[model samples]
Target: MQPAVTERDLNQADVADAARYLAGRIVPTPMLGCPELDELAGTRLLLKAENLQHSGSYKMRGATVAVGRLAAAGQATGVVCQSTGNHAAAVAQAARRHGLAAVVVLPPDAAPAKVARAAAAGACVLRADGDPHEVVRQVHADTGYPVIDAYDHPDVVAGQGTAALELIEAAEAAGTPLDALVVPVGGGGGAAGAVLAATGRGIDVYGVEPYGCDSLARSLAAGHRVPVTPAATLADGLRPACVGALPFRVLRDSGIDAVGVGDDAIAHAFRLIVTHLKLVVEPSGAAALAGALRVAETSTHRTVGVLLTGGNVEADLVGRLMEGSAA
Candidate 1:
């Protein structure tokens, strides 16, 4: 029998308030309507181009919101966060914009490009060994600075909800009712926020995770949060060990679904975005499209919104990721 899972559900009112808080900080990335994707998936597809966000990823939305809120509160102690990679850059960029000192705690194995990018953004990068869990804890213990948690903070969840709010607006502008929305779940900030924002908006929200790193999926099945044993997967951005408490609460109460996909499918979708859409997508970013395509192929949704959560892949990694496929 599976163990109990944590719940991370938020109500529509809370999501709306969060969106209001993030109104001007994060841009409303365009949602491109794709006829071809719809044709292939058997449903209208709205691609939320968060890949075009300021940090080339959706992490910026949460970072900007989180940092901005702190700044608004006149917190002068500066900001720090632990990340796989993207969140580091996002936090650094956001901190820079707010004139705040930034420190990034990164796993030792974090991509070199990610390290360079965070450093370029004026963040102090501290590399740690063993698991991400241990590293993040140590960073928090050492730095007494309030850690801007990547996925666990309520403000971060609220900020991430802004993405889904924008997507819903875009879909409404296109005069279509969205039946479902798909997002790549890492620590479940974006997925939890998306689910929270979609409530009463008449859209079903689904979180997609890499097969080997199905934290949210496992948590949902367990009816509480479950720590996932890390496995090798190319979707580094979504390889979280456990679903955050807030995200689990939101997922449990929000009635959202979780989908787990394989690495090969994510790679194929990554290549497809480059070849067909001329968009650079990281493996984790492609997970939503993979889920969207799968859902469109199998479900009866008339329209599905796929959030392209990030595009911060290193230039060299792109070649390796799309090696055998056409560019």
Candidate 2:
């Protein structure tokens, strides 16, 4: 028998309230009807263009709620987090708006454009020598600041659900009911929140990750959160080695499906999105669309909603990726 896994799940009772709070703040990114994508997927695909979202990713949704929750509680002394890029910028921007100090710990090799954005937003950017987990530990020790985990906290997970909420409402209002919802998975918060949102709506929720970073797939199979050694992948935003415990719990309890797409497929989808959908999305953001194409090719899900999560690629990187020369 397989060994039992260990982790905590967040059944956020206030997820609906989180959605309402975010609705009042953010620009509702569009659910674009792209027939070109539909043909590529061989299904009706409604692309939620979250690349246009604040902070250039869906991270803003959770960032707003997390920082706002602290501010509302009168405890907004400061917040710290670790990220590859987009989440750091989101937290920094949200912290600035709430009049709180923000510290973003990232690897020295973090994306230049995203790092610049976070710095511009007034976050004290730290390039830690150790792993992000260690950096977070030391940050807490020195600053005693509250840590806002990118996708592990319930507030953040609930905030991520707003995209799904918006997608559902927009699809319904347009007289098109969705059958499945697909998005990229990293820490799994967005996908977990999506499961929470799509559960009773009779919509199947799916999370797509880069093949080399298929943490959620392995975790679900193991019946617990399992760590992995990640390989180089273009989907940097979705390259976490382990699924967050909270997100793992939500996905396991809710029975949402997870899939993986190869780097080649992701590259193909990235270019297709630019040329056909005319949307500028980074590789991680394009993961869902790529996964949906795979699903449409083999599955019975006819109408799938794909969340394009971010577009904050550096200029040189984008050019190299588009030229198909990026390693």
- For lDDT, the strongest prediction is 2
TM agreement with the true structure for every prediction: 0.91, 0.94
Per-residue lDDT of candidate 2, residues 156-180 (tens digit): 8888888887898789899898989
lDDT tens string, model 1, 70-158?
77767556787889998899999988988888889888778777788789999999886766556666766776566788988777777
- Candidate 2 RMSD to the correct structure: 4.5
Ten residues in a row with the worst lDDT in model 2? 1-10
What value of lDDT does candidate 1 attain over all alpha carbons? 0.80
Best by TM-score: 2
